[model samples]
Target: MQGLSAWRDDRCLYCDVDLSLPTGTVMQIRGPNGAGKTTLLKHIAGLSGRRAGQVSWASTDSHDDRDTFTQQMLYLGHLPGVKSALTVAENLQALAACRGINLLTHTISQALNTVHLGGYDDMPCHQLSAGQLRRVALARLFTEPVPLWLLDEPFTAIDQAGVRELEGWLAAHSEQGGVVLLTTHHPLALNCPLQFLDLQPIVEDWH
Candidate 1:
């Protein structure tokens, strides 16, 4: 992105933001509360249009080939985005279907197991705890074939073990030439180097 700017209630959340991420890279957005971390992610994911900036993919403008870009990217927001009444497996299937992805039964089972949701696949999501529900959402990552990931607070409500597992997944994705951009408070322990973008408040000088 270049010259990215956003406003909320006439208050500037951020301005003149610039970023670039290449393959096999992992970038973390760091800032204090209300620093527009989520806003930046939303813009990159094309979820929010109230911003001034240019987002490109593979040296081509995103606006020029939005359909292709959308197919290559996956964005996970704060909410789990699961149906409460659906079974864990069913929810995963539903999410994949919404994205027009076809997941075989074994693929769904493998993804569930990857997030440590193994035998719980048949259980109703409403019966699962908060962390379990989060896991259900995270399982999507394992099944998604896209190379670019935009995650907001992906580590929330999960245990230390889950955090470590996620870090491993991020590292693996990077090693396999995928790109990941995420916002999280937990210190990442990945073996790969992490690039950072700190969104300072508008009151502060930005360099």
Candidate 2:
């Protein structure tokens, strides 16, 4: 359960805040605009440097392995990390390759279908609508198996159905003993137990 504890300094975006997220727990970081929720998520994802406090992962070994930690986590930012010139299937294939996971065309199709983008698999990302593009970014959740998922503003441009689909995926991930840390302004309706970690109070000055 116990994992990382992170905080910030004067120049840090989120300011002074520390949090300890346990494993397999769905923690929601809620805040107003410019509260640094995304910044915090990036820190947890190991995409940003910590200015003050440390982000420590629990390990039984004598030393913490950065490569292992990176491999254990997946960070989905607000922007869809896709190539505009590439087809939907190609994007997933590239991501899987970068992560050292081999993805088949059938698996990519299934992932696209799970996100309700089955018919758009052959289309380039630039041609897809904003919602469909978001769906394409989300399709990776089904095509790959990663233990920890760190998502920032995942519900930004999706419709109600997309939200529900994402909720279902999150529930399934948590059911399999996976950890999820995300930032969302919209409320989520799920069948499993959930926890809310309000970051609104922590970064009030930024607004």
Candidate 3:
């Protein structure tokens, strides 16, 4: 699979900017608050309708191939998609089932351990601290292997150590030829070659 072009329309928040990100690359979308970072991520994740332009995947011209695109991508947004009522293990298991990945007990345990949540897997997410919950969310990175990762504000609520662990995981993912597109204000301590896209330049006109 190759990269795709993401174009914007006049009614779109980003106006006329179009970005083409190469495959197997780590693309960072940087901007101030409310600069459409989340919007761009939503579009890439196939959660939002394109106002005018399109996002193509693998050079395929068929819009019916969205499922094909979705299968190759794992999207982690501002919300961890965790249920406050469920245990950490249950949340991961549910997500794995929905994504059609068979998440084993050992895999869940190892993922929690990677995110430093080994002892908290059986606990309710509400019982965990904000940072700990974020770690639990990030633990999915270890349990699942997808080609494209789209994360919005992944560093939110994470401590320094947790941030380091997440960065290391991302670096390793890119090294294994996986592509990552994320929005983060925190300076990343990564060894991989990163491409930065400043979304601030694409301002919307309210007129």
Candidate 4:
């Protein structure tokens, strides 16, 4: 995005923000609480309304061709976004169906196993712990091989081992020519080059 800005109330949360990420790069948006880190991710994902500046994909206007952008991007918000009544496998299946991809039972099983949710497939999402629910949302990374991943606070509620596994996945994705932009407080130990964008409260000058 070029000169991208967002509003929290009537006042601007961030102003004149500019950012760009190339292929095979992992960028972490870092800041203290309410620093517009998540706002930036949502803006880039076209989830929030734009107040200022532009977002483009490969030099093409992202808003003009949202379908193309959506097809190439995978977004996971901080919230699990899973249905409480749905079983673990059913949730993943619903997610795949939304992306127009039909995953087989074996594929779903394997993805759950990868996220360490192997045996919980038949259990309702509400029956699992918070971390497990997050893992259910995370299983999408294994199923959808999109080029761009926008994750907001993806490391929340997960244990150390899950964090390590996710770190490895991020590195592998970058190495495979995928772009990852995420907001997380957890210090990432990615083997690949990891970039950071720190969002601070915009200071205006009155002369």
Best by lDDT: 1
The better-scoring model by TM-score among 1 and 3 is 1
Superior by lDDT: candidate 2 or candidate 4: 4
TM-score of 4: 0.94
Who is ahead in lDDT, 3 or 4? 4
Better of 3 and 4 by TM-score: 4
Tens digits of per-residue lDDT for model 3, 1-207? 223223455444565556665666898998887677887788777776553356666776325687778777888988777999999999999988887888889999988888888877789988988888788788888777787899999999998887887888888888888889999988988989999878764445669
Q: What's the lDDT of the predicted structure labeled candidate 2?
A: 0.76
Off-target runs (Cα >4 Å) in candidate 4 are: 203-207
Decreasing lDDT order of the candidates? 1, 4, 3, 2
TM-score ranking from best candidate downward: 1, 4, 3, 2
Across residues 1-207, which tens digit of lDDT does each residue of candidate 4 receive? 799899876657788888888999899988888788888888888887647778888888787898888888999999999999999998989988998989898998889899998888789988999999999999999887799999998999999998999999999999999999999878889999999998887655657
- Deviation from native of the Cα of residue 188 in model 2, angstroms: 1.5
RMSD of each: 2.5, 3.6, 3.2, 1.7
Off by over 4 Å in 2: 1-10, 15-18, 58-63, 200-207
Task: List lDDT for all candidates, in order.
Answer: 0.90, 0.76, 0.79, 0.89
TM-score of each: 0.94, 0.85, 0.87, 0.94
- Pairs that collide in candidate 2 are 1-23
lDDT, model 3, position 52: 38
Per model, how many backbone clashes are there? 0, 1, 0, 0
For candidate 2, lDDT tens digit of each residue in 126-152? 898888878888888877778888998
